[model samples]
Target: QIAQESEPGLAVYALAAQADMYRWRGDHAQARAVLSKARQLAEEKGLDFEQRGLLPVAEGITLAESGEVKAGLRLLSDGVRFLEQRRAKRELARARFLLAKAHLLAGDKPQAVGELRRALDLAEEIGTHQFAVVEGQHAVGLLKLGIAQGVAPCRALAEKVQQLGGLGAAEVRTGEGAEEGAASRLEIYALGEGRVVRDGHTVSSSEWRTAIVKELFFYILLHGPLERDAIGVVFWPDVSAKKMADSFHTTLYRMRRALGGDVVVVEGGQYRLGDVDYWFDVEEFEALVERARLLPPHAWQAEDLWRRAVALYRGDFLPEVQRVWCVPKREALREMYLEALVGMGRCHEARREFEGAVGWYRRALEVDELREDIHRRIMHCHAQAGRRSEALAQYHRCREILKRELDIEPSVETKGLYERMAGKGPD
Candidate 1:
């Protein structure tokens, strides 16, 4: 009620929680009614919450109980898929547990067991046991299974359920277990466009408190576990040490609040982000390129690795940021991207795939437009493809771009290639 009166944008969460409680009590009508309000409020107010997925899940379970089993099951399945895509592990585990109950009630013991096992595994992996409702639901399912499938296999499950019954009164704790549960699985892309995708949702700049906060995020990621002093020196170089400390602490607090406290941990006079599993596009690009480089040119996997690396280089690292610190790293990644592209082109050239070779070389030219070497390669590919006019056109395009942009002509090798393509011979 307070949420509805004071902060209505958050009211949908309370409604969803009430609906889950109703569902736990087996009051299908009340569950559905609460979910209806939640869905309506969520739609009307544009409220985004992690618990929003619970509405569909609870509704599906209610429908399954009221004898609309197939429709209910379908909704349940869809809800699970949706939550999984959202990376809502807690919600997904609950949904799976509910689906298991539905399966057991419908007399599909094997399917019920399968769903229960999946729910348990996911819950354990996420390190959360807050769902006593889910545990009760699971226990009930296992009891049914034990009756039908004999006592031996479900003995341990029965024991687990007994343990879960006492955990309802447990306080929601925050340290390692909770941190693991709440830590967003991030996929950061800093290679080209900077994107911080947390749990499959791309965090918009609007979500940040300030540009500095966002930069701090990338800064910590780029240079991990820096001391408070070192960080101050880099970002607040002009400020006094005491002033820098105050500003740094304030910024750090905001970062922790915005990105999760566990995500930015301070310890032993230094700060580092939590050990969350993350995939950085730049790291992946480098790994793929390194692997590709290690393989022989004719190796089947080499071309695929090189292409994957090229695809990952979306642009220069954090192109919008003009910090002095970002310059050398950005240039290094650009060079790595170019190397992968050129390597792929050469690999295709060696395989007698002239058109494929030209495609990659052209891609390289798109990044480094002044690369007369790639321009020469494109001309060679066009000539080999029997399009002499296009070959000649590519040479002229290269020559014009160089002259217009740099007030310089193509190199000797480029000129030689142009002459050969012009049928004036290599001399």
Candidate 2:
């Protein structure tokens, strides 16, 4: 009906509406084409700012659905700026809705929620039914964000979704419920190549008798066989020494029995996993670290090995377990992982792999924001790659963070690197 209106300036609005309809129907290519025509027509006619602002948003939505997520996000952000400039609440809300979806697809849920909340506020201001519908969809996204943050509201949100008849209710329910179930289960992982099966079925360590035994196995694999005292301190820190030792012996006996007398040994008062064809994931991660550390400096394989090591670290070491003994080990392993990332970034920088090095350095910073060395490395990599603008931006960002968080200045090395990049120092 809107498209049938024959008014001169209404054509662009008509095209935008049609494009939105197509977009909702999952015909992204057609939507993009229509939006492109609308944008061109709007510009040629010198249409009002309201009609002109929808083009970038429609393009962004099309690009996101077409697998150009990063580009789509940038475009949507641009569209939001234009809408805000015009103070067009309706167009702004629509653009923000698209931006939220784009960020959600990019694994940036926190940003998505912020955009969605703003969109909802605009929707309320404009009294639009479409915004109300999107608000309902945003609820599901909010539920996902809650789950990712490990908040208790995740369960409540899931239940609310079940009651509301939203599109992703089943998915949210199943994904969160499955995660909760797996989290409660005591599973042991073998870290190696090839498949191992027993009686034509894959072997599972969850069939073990107790959670403590499984935990002990995980610890040994992660920390490379701790002494009895260390193990006692970690898992049973609050218990009496005698009770802790007794509990450790009991858990060890169960683990040994579960492995069927074939795969565990005690050597020099330290319990070790026996030589087995299959390796645990933790063991494989440790081996990768060792291999990367042992590689000749500037070896081509070092970055590849380091990437594999980083990939294996799905989250913090044993995120499910939070004992006093585990905290130090977790922190230590995290530091080691961040350093490995820094090493890989430096290696890549030396080889002129600027983008790859940037990725590694960014990941290192994500893992340890306090690591001034990584900040300097990132600044240096950006500068050396002829990205002087980005280098300057990074310097400002580091300076702000240091001032705000630590009340300090950048190190002399960092200042020197920045000065060189800015062409203000020794050539």
Give the whole-model CA lDDT for all candidates, comma-separated: 0.71, 0.65
| Candidate 2 structure quality by residue, lDDT tens digits, 164-212 | 6753556555444221111122224432221224223443456455666
The CA lDDT at 132 in model 2 is: 37
Q: Judged by lDDT, which candidate is best?
A: 1
Could you list the CA RMSD of all candidates, in the order they appear? Answer: 17.3, 28.0
**Each model's TM-score, in the order given?**
0.55, 0.46
- Give candidate 1 misplaced runs (Cα > 4 Å): 1-177, 180-184, 201-207, 266-268, 423-427
- Model 1 lDDT at residue 159: 46
What are the per-residue Cα lDDT tens digits for candidate 1 across 282-357? 8888899889989877788998999898778877899888779899999898988998999998898888798999
TM-score of decoy 2: 0.46
Model 1, global lDDT = 0.71
Clashing pairs in 1: none
